[model samples]
Target: MGASSPPRVTGRLRRTSLVDQAIAALQAEIDSGAWAVGEKIPTEPQLVERFGIGRNALREAIRALVHSGLLETRQGDGTYLRATSEFAGALRRRTSCSELLELVEVRRAIEVEAARLAAKRRSDRQAAELERLLAESAAAWRAGDVGRLVGADVALHTEIVRASGNAMLLELYESFGGAIAEAIRTELLDTATYSRPTHSALVAAIVAGDPQAAAAATAAALDEVRIGRERRSIGQPSR
Candidate 1:
């Protein structure tokens, strides 16, 4: 006879963002069939006790899972399991600020050349779209809408890649869009200042057909963003 499988044990979460860690753990449990679809999850007290997390933290985790469609809440009934798994769910894991800064660096590496090529080859339509996206990004910032800012930032960079006239470069940038948006959203939290090489300057360089200036402006802008994130992480004021 085959040996019996060992009893399952949920690991204790360490000190960090308890809500985020709880969300990850609960999602894994749902994926592993610890809670089947259509079945209600444990009571709030049970979950809080089981996870050794505060009530507020566990509730926030449940709320996030509900938002992600992995779970659903009923009116005074209970939260029911929804999805067993999600494609790219692991990619949605909460990233450390430093890890997100690394993603920004990677994205900058792609966009620097993209900006250079765009300066050399942008069409009138691509230039117009880039300008529109920059305006929208600035508007979103002024309105304190981080979500809109993320979308606008992605759109502007995407337009630059499109203007590069290189299908492979555009494809590469497309693949990184979602992760880049996630990082940017995290990095911009509580950041009231926009970085150097303002959108206008970058666009002006591209409009002037100056590849070197465009690339330099792109580097400076992304480096400023990176520095801002580093400062945020260390609790230092951004320069």
Candidate 2:
């Protein structure tokens, strides 16, 4: 009798067996916080037994997570978690310094227009909110809390964008906030001395209901960001 061919590896079964299921199972463990950040995962034997997966499948899953920045493997030690959320991990892995600088420019474009629109359209309540946010941010700056200052600065500008009365514009700004914050935090300590007055000038323009002044303030604020980025790029001491 002719030799029987080995079992064919059908596409459907292969799809179900190795790649997708392993990735999904591992990612679920991460998303559910089964493994906390900086915590080491189970050894290969334990994972293989728990998941009923072979060493090969478990290794593939580990490799995928490491590539995604969710985990890191030490040469001698076990794999360790690097981030809490997948999106945050992926964002950290993907964003380069040059890309962050480009994002600053994008923020400048959105915020400049939003400031003008806000000056023209903000209601009294929105104006009050802007003032309060700016005050919180300035206080954070004066307290030498760069972390809190970054949060407040993002909040105040986000509020200004909302006051523009354009839903789409607000959505875009909200989506980009994470990336912008990452960029902002890089030089925030060095730039804090300038940021307080720059943000104050923006709030002043918005409150005065002068579109031209608001636009100019936005420009000035973004210029400071640009200068900060350039200093970091060239390794100059932040003034």
Candidate 3:
């Protein structure tokens, strides 16, 4: 049969096997939670070392994950873990409109109490951390870096939740992080609204050890989001 076709020599099968193995290895990294969503993944060389595979195979694996919505490549900004999986990606996409408003409400409920408890029980170290994040958020706001602004706000609020000394509450807030990020970004896109999280007030309250003030400040921050969303939905100009 045509000289046995030279034993059907082809690197195709080997390449396919290597790509598949790299894909599997990358999945394990996502599932392990060491690589978080929205965080940039390691460099190509680092990934090659991590997967013990060729660079080409790793690129194919990353491309596949990107096509699957699990990764995102930001043109010279490096690749980021966009989602834990396809299902999570779809879930995040669906968090909009009324569902997102409901989530904001949920955040208000959790964060109000968290700020209250944090004010009553926070350590000096935690308070300082909150102050640091507040300054970072302010700087980001001034610099017009929406991503950093949202990140700092998220970290600042998470610190408040952490100071509450309630592990369960902190976990819940962390789990909602992706959706919350979307909400913050959307609101921030409307520069006219400018309704940002009340960082200075909230941090001041927490630092001052005033439960009522801390809770009030948190509520005010979230209320800005809600009010802006409502005005936009009604096609009204920002006040």
Candidate 4:
């Protein structure tokens, strides 16, 4: 009999589970402005030692930040931080209702396209999820719960965008997540009516997969919200 071949040895993949540590180290550097936009990151070996992790784990952490658009990598050059907006500066600048209206107008443009795409491309699973969220929104409105209503509203619109099956559009929407949520809370929740037929109409249009009707219903709902804000402003005593 031929000599039995030596049992093949399979070495387990060695990896660091210290993902959080690596993320924290890099986040601290970014927060401290040590890594400015366009600045190339340190080499993989350097990062491994700096973050005290195996090369594989460090690479994974970098990959996560890259997906979030905070970092970018070049095939041969190096990874670099992407330019980020200074949200603090934006907050410091006062914004008027007119500006808010313009923001809503932009949202309308984006959402109209999203709704159209969703109507044409959404899978059965996505449609069902949209219906579920709309039902939740209706229940919240009937209960006069602004918080729940706003949450449901955000989820419903997010689902619509997701159903559009456009990665770039979805990414753009996610980038504005915080600002959009705040806008809904300050603008819509403050003025939304519990008995508004427009609310139901919008949900119905989305459920029925009627993109044009969805767009119209959304516009109408926003119009009423703008009117409510105006009325509130007029009713307030002069400061």
Stretches of candidate 1 above 4 Å error?
Answer: 1-94
lDDT of 4 by residue, 62-134 (tens): 8877766667789989897653333422421224666566656666777778777777678889878987888
TM-score order, best first, reads 3, 2, 1, 4
Give the least accurate 10-residue stretch of model 1, judged by summed lDDT: 85-94
For candidate 1, write residues 150-224 as lDDT tens digits: 778878888988999999998667655545666667667757555523677898899889999999888888888
- Candidate ranking under lDDT, highest first, comes to 3, 2, 1, 4
Q: Model 1 scores what on Cα lDDT?
A: 0.77
| Per-model TM values vs. the true structure | 0.61, 0.64, 0.75, 0.56
Q: Report the CA-based lDDT of candidate 4 relative to the real structure.
A: 0.68
What C-alpha lDDT values do all the predictions have?
0.77, 0.79, 0.82, 0.68
Whichever of 2 and 4 has more TM-score, that candidate is: 2
Which candidate achieves the best TM-score against the true structure?
3
Work out how many backbone clashes candidate 3 has: 0
Clashes (candidate 2): 0
Show the lowest summed lDDT stretch of 10 residues, model 2. Answer: 85-94
Q: What is the C-alpha RMSD of each candidate to the true structure, in Å?
A: 11.1, 6.7, 5.4, 13.9
CA displacement after TM-score superposition, residue 200 of candidate 1 (Å): 1.4
Q: After superposition, how far is residue 47 of candidate 3 from its true place, in Å?
A: 2.4
lDDT of 1 at 198: 66
List ranges where model 4 is wrong by over 4 Å: 1-95, 192-196, 227-239
**Candidate 3 lDDT by residue in tens digits, 1-239:** 46554575469988899899999999999889988778999999998997798999999999998887778889978999877767555445755567667777889999999999999999999998998888888888889888888888778888999999999998777766666777777777864233335677888898999999999988998887777667767788656
By summed lDDT, which 10 consecutive residues of candidate 3 come out lowest? 190-199
